[model samples]
Target: MRYKLGWASRFGVALLMGILTFSLVVTTAPTQIQGAIAQATAAARQQQREQQVRQVRPETYDLSRYPVTDANERHWRNVLWTTGVVEPQEPYVAEAIAQIVSLTARSGLSRPQQRTVEMAMQIATQLYFSNPTGYAAIGQQFLQTVERSPNPEWSAMALSALVKTGLDPQQRQRLGDRLRQRFPQWNQDIYLFTTLRDLALLQQTPTTPPLGDLLKWTIAPNQVHLYVICRPDRGVLCQTVVKDGNGQFLRENGQLWSIPLLLRSLHELSWNFTRGQTPQGIYRIEGVRPANMETFRAYGAYDLVKLFAPYEEGVREFVPGRPGQLPATLTAYQALLPPSWRNYFPIQQSYWAGKAGRGLFRIHGSGEDPGFFTNNNRYPKSLGWNPAIGCLSALELYDDTGRLQQADMPPILNALTRLGGRSFTGYLTVVEVPGADTPVSIAEIEAAINS
Candidate 1:
């Protein structure tokens, strides 16, 4: 049986013990426990050797001052909640105000606890969107701590959290300036991706457009935005761009993959239920789905994916009935549909007239099996290209062992959710540019980035 890491308890007490024990082993060990003594001695020697070899401090931080507050009850609760401690009574989301107040008291924190504190701040940021003035003091305190910390892990978490605190433009500029100095070079790190996004937004100088022609479609002018640019011929090289309400680019041209299937043309939405041709044109994301039984049955785990619609241009609205109660004409089409595609609900419905065989199209993970969508061995190995029926493309991140898994998607999904908010209800325009049959060139992507 494949061992699935339980999210709620994945990094719980056991992890804390391991961290604490690792710290203890660095200092002392009893000679009675022969095996543990040998291990500890060797680990201590290795740590000493590493420390001597480099002036840079070790990656780990001191968490002794963590759970950073006087109120022990609320501190542990927020910590457990942040760390995914799954207990029935200990719900994930308590009152946002309580979490914010609890976090305010604490000062010195390790990288791990800083991350927890960041999560708490995020809850407050999302909750108090209308009135973020209440969090000004908390944001400043957290910002000062992050600014003082030299550890990259802690600084990265703190800086990113500071952005979400809804700090004023001056504060955002200060954070951005600090980030630019720290992360001078750019790789595919998502944290840096978000940092760059906030930097651009804070600057807000009406700079050059990031996504080029894709910007034309995303002109709705909303607080949250997602631009999915599909290059069907390029397969895995689709680009997902995110922006704040003021049209400032946040995440510029991040890598995202899609179903490897190619469309017959730019206009084709889908051919069948299973072998879907990615539809072109604009679609609005009306719903965000969490993992459920149906999802688990289909993908081996409950993964989050946004449901988009007007499956194709002018093709909106299901037949006037419930899921199974399709009209006679629709029923005929449903009989020919694949089992997986049947009974899919619309996140966004349209009342337009001309309707063809277009239904569910979502941006989802690669599921439990990396090659599950492509029959385990039938597809290309490029993340640039994967298989999707008629759905917009998505990615399931690689695990620590470098294997793709469904569970790895949560972090990236959370990033998207953070950009769009908890509900993530917003405009999602999917633009497909045709005639470029070759895989998306690196030059083209770089141009998008620099633009």
Candidate 2:
């Protein structure tokens, strides 16, 4: 009985040991499997990170080697849109597009090819604004390229982008329309002409002449205003205090003149004309009268001297006398006038005289009289009078005659500066009427003009 009991105990102990071993295997197997799964997941995650990095890595491109043809422009466009091309460590896609556009435009390509590049640039600009990722970098590059581009389209595009980012929809639309109309062909001539016209128009008051008429009369060279004209024909006629047959003030054809030709002649005389052989006293006399020497001293001679000095260049020899001095040949003066002003003399004369008196004198009255507004009234308020038209006319005269000097150009410059002052900076706002009393900053105005 003792032996049988001992055998049963040993069997029970063996069964218990087997059970313990099975439990140990069951618990450790799951732990091992879990560790393997964790390591696999880590490896997969690392691989994905590496792949993403590679995708965005910069690839070398031979930009110069790529032929800049209209057909190839599409390829450049695609490069800009490709994902991950503008990563931080990579060449910026926006910068690349700008470079491509500029190079393509200036590559001596055909008109169609140039146009294609412009279209591509416009599309790129649109994309830049639409997505606006890394927009600051994109904008900086765009501005740099635009300033360097000869194509007007690039400038217009840059301006539009600025408007989009800085201005409200209404302002943006208005400016965009104006820019589109002005730069329809994207050539320098049209672009520069439109820019000047728009700048002049902005300063126009209700009393200003029609835009067409203003353009016909006003001439500008290097963006400065010279002289103003009233009529376009009979050559610039005026009433000045000259020594006349009766020693009285008389109105006559003082001289035939334009600004551009005058400046050219003056420059020639100053630097190129033969010494002594150059004619003396080229200005013609209109009349002489019992006049106020004080008036002559205050404005007349000074004004004429300042007006003529642009052409003098230290070579002009003039007859030293009273306010009324006549010259032998007015040919030099006549040549300076714009071709558009040749037949419109009547209007040109009136315009010229009116401006000479600082819009303070008028011809509407029976005799030359003070304008309705006093000189005191000629402050910022008086800027409303067709000052833009007058200024533009003056500029035209200067441009035609080459009389527009860097100095003595404050009045015309003031008109432009004031006009530009009506805009807002880093943003756009459209005022339907340019002369509205809306307050604007000088900086904003400058930005709008430059843009």
Candidate 3:
């Protein structure tokens, strides 16, 4: 939500200041001046990326159009699965599992490389929907990955996988205790702590939100139900829906605005858990990001509402565009709403997730179709609605002549703008409400809203 001078502007200002001094060296040696200018420009750009990263944890592609390369088949496949580009079935899932197995047999790995750890986590997450709770298939094997190095990143992910295995509670507790003792040395790592916290939480049941919490959040302007469970009858479909309109948020002027957020991501991970698909919780609506070469094929042009999770690293200063005195604690996050809402668990999912270290997020449309040719998707993929890592993706369709056929994000933009004007700063609450086995029919949401 915060804006700053562009890198070019900053560089220009610095150059102007330097020119005003009229240095003899600058006048005499053009090459040195050019090199200095280049260095200054490079430094300013890097600073900008870092600053932007704190508030908006955009995909690298979003930042600078970095394309996924398949020079390394293992990495490419993992990327495909992680990005939801490919479904978690057949050769894709099988091959990704094989890559993790292969990583184990290799030698000369005293410590896992950064990419190695990251790719492993990526595959491990999607593996949940594929393997379910007892992630037994990949747990022990990846534990070896963690044992290879005591590094926190590897340790955090490996331990996360291990906790899902049949590890005893007492043993898990002791191990977790030991790790926390070592945390201070690593500057009291929050990711490590929260990662383990998620492990412990998975072992227990979540506190059920009161009915009012579910009702209010269901009709909230930017509601998204991204947590999904695959049932026998429904396959894998979103568990929440609305009544009057399939997906609309009512504005203050009493107008029914449609943002078309009928979304689905079958990342079996539960509410508030970012270790899964899109998290359930409060997010700050921080405007949009137009499509780039890396994202255009999947996400279309001039769209994408950036959702900033509270407590997200670098976004500590951002209070979601909700009313109330600004407070930043996990409990304080809910205080932005009415007193009655502070106790709402479902609406607070993302606030917890941000504190746990999953931050950069968005609500955008994708042109990619997971079920265009093959029915790889568990349920029918509506409007080419494919999955995104942790984003709430909507349908944005176009016709042959590039005429807009269907688009959902623009309305979402309008609704948020109505709530927060040009900055489009508002709170987006994602929750996992009732209903399973059957699809959340349009009637059900309408009934709920009307009542």
* Per-model TM-score versus the true fold: 0.37, 0.24, 0.57
TM-score of 3: 0.57
Count residue pairs with overlapping backbones in model 2: 37
Superposed on all Cα atoms, model 2 deviates from the true structure by an RMSD in Å of 37.3
Most accurate candidate by lDDT? 3
lDDT of 3 by residue, 227-313 (tens): 221222222334322222224434323432233343344443333344346665556655666544344435543357776777654
lDDT of 1: 0.39
Question: Residue-wise lDDT of candidate 2 within 86-203, one digit each (tens)?
Answer: 2222345455555555553254677656655655455455445534555455565555544555556455555545544555555545554555464555333433333333333334
User: Taking the tens digit of each residue's C-alpha lDDT, what string does model 1 give over 31-135?
Assistant: 322322332233433553344333211121113433344444455444433222111111122333334434434566655555555445433332232223554
Q: Better model by TM-score, 2 or 3?
A: 3
Candidate 3 — which residues are off by over 4 angstroms? Answer: 1-112, 127-140, 143-207, 211-276, 291-294, 313-317, 320-328, 337-347, 372-376, 381-383, 398-404, 418-420, 437-451
What lDDT would each prediction earn against the true structure? 0.39, 0.30, 0.47
